[model samples]
Target chain A: MNVQDIQRILRADLLCGEEHLGREVQTACGSDMMSDVLAYVKEQSVLLTGLVNPQVIRTAEMMDMVCIVFVRGKRPNEDMIELAKERSIVVMSTKFRMFTACGLLYEGGLKGGCKV
Target chain B: MHYVVPPDDFTRAGEASSAVKKTLKQIGMNPDVIRRVAIAMYEGEINMVIHAHGGEITVDVAPDRVDMVLADEGPGIADIERAMQAGYSTAPEEVRNLGFGAGMGLPNMKKYTDEMTVESTLGVGTTVRMSVFNHAG
Candidate 1:
């Protein structure tokens, strides 16, 4: 699915990178721990996380992730948004909790994309 | 390229890795190779900020490989074997609160690089050297 589909499915608000809404993402990973995300994620284009920090954007960039979905309505600060903007990474916020957000995305056919 | 990591500055930790990624992109390196270098170096950068109070990172990018050397003066790891375990972490709760310190830093660095070596002197310092080879060329 595309970022647009994820936004609609999760009732999310686009924070930035609106131009990327049409971009396709086949997989996603959900985690609050950046280390776990870094260690296990493989080719996932979307990250559903509750953590709000600049490192989130950095982690996404390092992994070449195209977008980050902040679960539980946790909004990022200006620094995070600015960093994401520089990297052209889509940032969104959703009211759904972590589990539900991952569930909705998975139910919508987004695999975990873990390389276990 | 050389970067000095300011002590405990979590927000600025990834700057070096990001710069390296941009440089690699400008040079038309393979996306996979660039991602590996970025992830490995970024993980080391975060480790420096979290545990070492700060450190120095030197990067050397060549046509066939990208090499990174991270050195820091901190309370060196007492047990390298245990520290490499997936869930073992010495980072305090505050660091964990920031969404890191999951004990995956070194392991992830090792996983993404073609070569990795760690040298630590207790109460002195630790140095991690890693290299990722360009396979797309």
Candidate 2:
């Protein structure tokens, strides 16, 4: 699915990368731990996480992820948002908790990127 | 390229890796190779901040391979074999609260890079060397 589908499914507010809402993403994974997120390699992927830090943005950037959705209504700081903006990764915040948000996205046809 | 990773600056930890990624992209390297190098180097960068008291990273890009060397003057790894395991981390609780310290750092670095080695000394420092091949055979 594309970034718009994820936004609509999760009822998320776009924090940055407004121009990239149409960007295509093949898969997604949700995790609070950046270490787990870094272990997988996905192309054109979306990252869903509750963690709010500069490392989240850096992790997405390194993995070439197209978007990051902050779960549990957690919003990142200006520095993190600015970093995501600079890297062109779409950033969004959703009120739904992690499980619900991920389930909704999965039900909306977004599949997990992990092989195991 | 050479970079001095500032000590304990978690926010700026991945700058070196990010810059190297941009350079590889601009030079028109293959996307897969670039991603491997970026991810491996990024993991190393994070490890330096979370464990070491900052470090130095040097990257050499060539037609066939890209080599990354990270050196940190921190308490060296106590056991290289155990550290290589996927779920063994010595990072403190504060680091884990920051969404890291899950113990996959070293493994992820190894997973992404084609070649990797670790050299460490007690009360001295640690150095990690990794290589990613530009071309797949």
User: What is the docking quality class of candidate 1?
Assistant: high
The per-model lDDT (C-alpha) reads 0.92, 0.92
lDDT, candidate 1, B1-137, per-residue tens: 99998998888999989999999999999999999999999999999999999999999989999989999998998999998887889999999999998888888888999999999999999999999998877
TM-score, prediction 2: 0.98
lDDT tens digits, residues A1-116, model 2?
A: 79998998888999999999998877888999998888878663999999999999999999999999999999999989999999999999999999999899888888896666
Worst-scoring 10-residue span by lDDT in model 1 chain B: B80-89
Over 4 Å off, model 1: none
DockQ value for model 2:
0.94
- CA displacement after TM-score superposition, residue A90 of candidate 1 (Å): 0.7
Best by DockQ: 2
Measured with C-alpha atoms, the lDDT of residue B82 in candidate 2 is 95
Model 2 lDDT at residue B4: 93
Q: Per-residue lDDT for B30-129 in model 2, tens only?
A: 8899999999999899899888889999999987899999999999999999999999999999999998899999999999988999999988999999
lDDT for position A4 in model 1: 94
